[model samples]
Target: MAVAAVGRGASCNAAARDLGCATSTVVSAVRRYREAGRGALRDRREGNGQRKVDERFRERLTRVLQRTPEDWGWCRPTWTRELLCLELERRGLPQVSVATMGRALTSLGARRKAARPIVQCPWPAWKRRRRLYELKCLHAHKPPEEPVLHVDEVDIHLNPKVGHDWCLPGQRRVVVTPGNNQKRFLAGALNVRTGKLTWVEGKSKASDLFIQLLWHLAGEYRRARRIHLVLDNAAVHTSQKTRKALAQLGGRIVLHFLPPYCPQGNRIERVWLDLHANVTRNHRCRTMDQLMVRVHAYLAARNAQRSASPCLRRADLRRTA
Candidate 1:
């Protein structure tokens, strides 16, 4: 309508007054209509007035992104989009907006991911021991009659696990967590050969709880002459009471300790990871009983799946006397 009024020789100011817009808006619209015809009068939805970031500028930005902000004499360890924009402008490139910088970075295949915590194993001997254990388990002439079980304990708190969930971009997800700090410790053993799991949940992770788990394992594998239990060097596992319990079991159970601070060596650690991902991550259980039910259900479902697999059956380790 503004363009039609201007085409009829109405002044830009008169058109603006009629259309309830600024004079500049009418003038610009008339110019667009004259230059590109009626197509320009219609809203261009493709570009949305955002300037396309240059390819050369993107390459330069990617190089900067590959390095920390400290490399550019900034006091920060990481780069924010605002910081990158400032750096780009400082380097005599086009003054890019933060949103444009983000788009450019994403186009360059860069992503925003949380940093994972890593602990470098101080003892290289642990790697060698782990490799040896794998070889013995995999390529032995005959399967070991005794089951090899990886044992570990995981503490589940009443507090909700803060994790990623489907939500609108730029919106934070709020998970309701109770003030009560009630916690349960699950002492679990994963059978390496049969892929079976046996676990006991307790209010506290103590030597007594550890001893009880050991007894439970003993009863679970009573037919086998000996069971090889791979575990970590937690204080409770090596305590005097635990040793006494092992002595009482005679030669029926043997404990193999992984190197200190080496959780990756315990296969049961992977089970805990799966458990958290399936039952606990982003979950808010109302009560301790509900949490226990969820945990038990997860374990039971896993055991059922394993039991169906013919390859994961219990090994016969008995020898003729």
Candidate 2:
């Protein structure tokens, strides 16, 4: 109340005159304000926040990730969320949260390793221009009635993708467990227009395997007059061997490459996400053959959807597919 009065330019004598209270109350409030600023208005019991990890702690964490976990007095060589926290605590840092450790590891480049060696950090400028030109050509023209298939491969992990469980606020949940064991490989193509899908189980994602899938698609969509293909700029996709094979198809198809780092523009990317969510997440397959069975079932289901809600009008599918 005194602070409120002070805000209104109420002098101590003026406050006393107006409220019939002692002037000492207003004087004390103004004096506290002059000494402490706005923070004086807040309750003293409120905590500020968690103490930050110091530079010493961050360096220690970097060192921990640099070596195998076993080297740091741990029995195992691998790093796990639980083990990271325990190690930090053992090293004299206050217990760090799993999420905090995860972020720190990422900053220090300790997350997933690159899938393959990158010969060049950045591609040549002309290479970039050519890719851009191809993308521009793709984006400017609407797909003809036939579908443009962007084929890709994803590993089908054996482990079930457990859904997030309910938890009280501020509590933690298990992120990973040893129980997951099933895994397989998935090769698929996405139709852009109606968002239809077609894919298969594959032995490998090698260049030959990819070409075989293309051949299968060509045979399947034979009655279709033309196919516009959108592919990534992968070494295998543009290799001389792959080109010679694609060229053998005559002028029946047009192959266009998407710009690097621009997978979001590919509708098939979303299809992969959907398949992972709906079909693969809960699946637990022991063998490649068993995983193939489930994959075929999922593919048939997707095909059924395509038949019911045809991705594009025969004309549109013919053109923009």
Clash counts for all predictions: 1, 17
- On residues 1-321, what C-alpha lDDT tens digit does candidate 1 reach at each position? 989998899999999998899999998998998899988888776666655488778878888887889999999988889999998888888887888888888888898887768766577876857755763564243246777888999998778677777889889887788778689999999888778899998989999888889999999888888888888878999999988999999968887777777687787888888778776777777887777777777677678776321122112101100
**What TM-score number comes out for model 1?**
0.65
Model 2 lDDT per residue over 1-321, tens place: 777776888777887778777888678767888899877766654584654466777798887877778788788867797898898898778887888777777767677553543344265768777776765566457555566777677777656676655689999565443364655566667766555566655656666766776777788788767777776766767777777778887766677766665565466776667666655555545554554555555556567665322232324322322
lDDT of 1 at 71: 93
Clash pairs for candidate 1? 145-317
Native-referenced Cα lDDT, model 1: 0.80
Show where candidate 1 strays beyond 4 Å. Answer: 1-34, 37-74, 82-101, 118-120, 124-144, 167-174, 306-321
Badly placed stretches (over 4 Å) of model 2 are 1-146, 161-183, 306-321
Q: Which candidate number would show the highest TM-score if scored against the true structure? A: 1
